[model samples]
Target: MKEIDCRGLPYLKIIREIKKYFNSIGEGEAIVIVNSELGRSNVLRYAAHKGYQLDEENEENRFLIKIEKRGCLEVEDEGEIFSILITREKLGEGDDDLGKILMNEYFEVLNEYDKLPKEILFLNSAVKLFHKDSMAMEEIRLLYKKGVNLLINDTSLEHYNLTDQITFGEITSMYDMVVAMKRAKKLIRL
Candidate 1:
């Protein structure tokens, strides 16, 4: 089996390297070693996204993920691929406190939905909602656990001085966000 040592690499780099390696082979098995949880999560998500069979083992200081890449599995059509773009901390304008409450309620309802969006892109002040102390953190975490891709704006995190405070979601660039938006069959902006 091919071995890809991604230990100590950043999450994005780990993904890029793994993708490159996988694209080079036809049908094969490979092992990926990563040190950080973020890196491990990214790799496993990528593998699943590509319809690869995976087996994971946690060692003392790192994770070993075995991926068996055959032909891509047939995924049933699940209707239009939609995404949500959130640009503010609240749902609508007006009173700040009321907006916060409305936003919290909005997420709570969204979490209870049977069909969730393909992803939720957080930008501007919306990035603040992913911070550890955010009121909607629980709902957000639940959405994440339910398989919603949470993409946060990297620049917004820096602007709000919350780059390190964010505990969930993937920090992504505007280019990546734009690509995601373009790929979505429908987009709900707020």
Candidate 2:
């Protein structure tokens, strides 16, 4: 294993960088080392929020990573965990207006949190937020601006004919969804 030096990057930047590496390489792992415990924990918190786990042996204030294969990453760090569960269409079922109200409330709740959920995964009718004409477009845009990751189902996009128009994140597979959910600390369903 190579001991890479990633000393100066911010937590989110490093996460994005690592994700990029994973994208191009299709698999690999890197240990994230920061100058301070706060930085390490900040990164760790996001990992945990996304339902990622640590190697049981990792000590507090440190980050450990060991690649299991080409594409899977295992990170261990000591920090609080948070989870956000989104498995629905339009934020809720039944009345459309009520669902809109609830979706706004969901976004507002996330806005108030000190540490938001690791990601917002959309499936089925839930993928509507990415539409250019969505009422929640601004709120979702704000969330993305704040470093929240957005992932929509690849097949869902095909179903809705949303393969174009969207200028955000990526289209993801169910396998990726499983990994995301596994890293989340708590899951909130709508």
| Best-fitting candidate, scored by lDDT | 1
How much does candidate 1 score in TM-score?
A: 0.59
Whole-model lDDT, model 2 = 0.63
Instruction: Report, for every candidate in turn, its global Cα lDDT versus the true structure.
Output: 0.87, 0.63
When summed lDDT is taken over every stretch of 10 residues in candidate 1, the lowest stretch is 72-81
What lDDT tens digits, residue by residue, belong to model 1 across residues 56-93?
99998899999998987624355768899999998787
- Runs in model 1 deviating more than 4 A are 1-78
Q: For residues 114-175, what per-residue lDDT tens digits would candidate 2 score against the true structure?
A: 46656788877677777887767777777888887888888788888987857886679989
| lDDT (Cα, 0-100) at 81 in candidate 1 | 82
Model 2: which ten-residue window has the lowest total lDDT?
65-74
For model 2, state the Cα shift of residue 1 in Å. 58
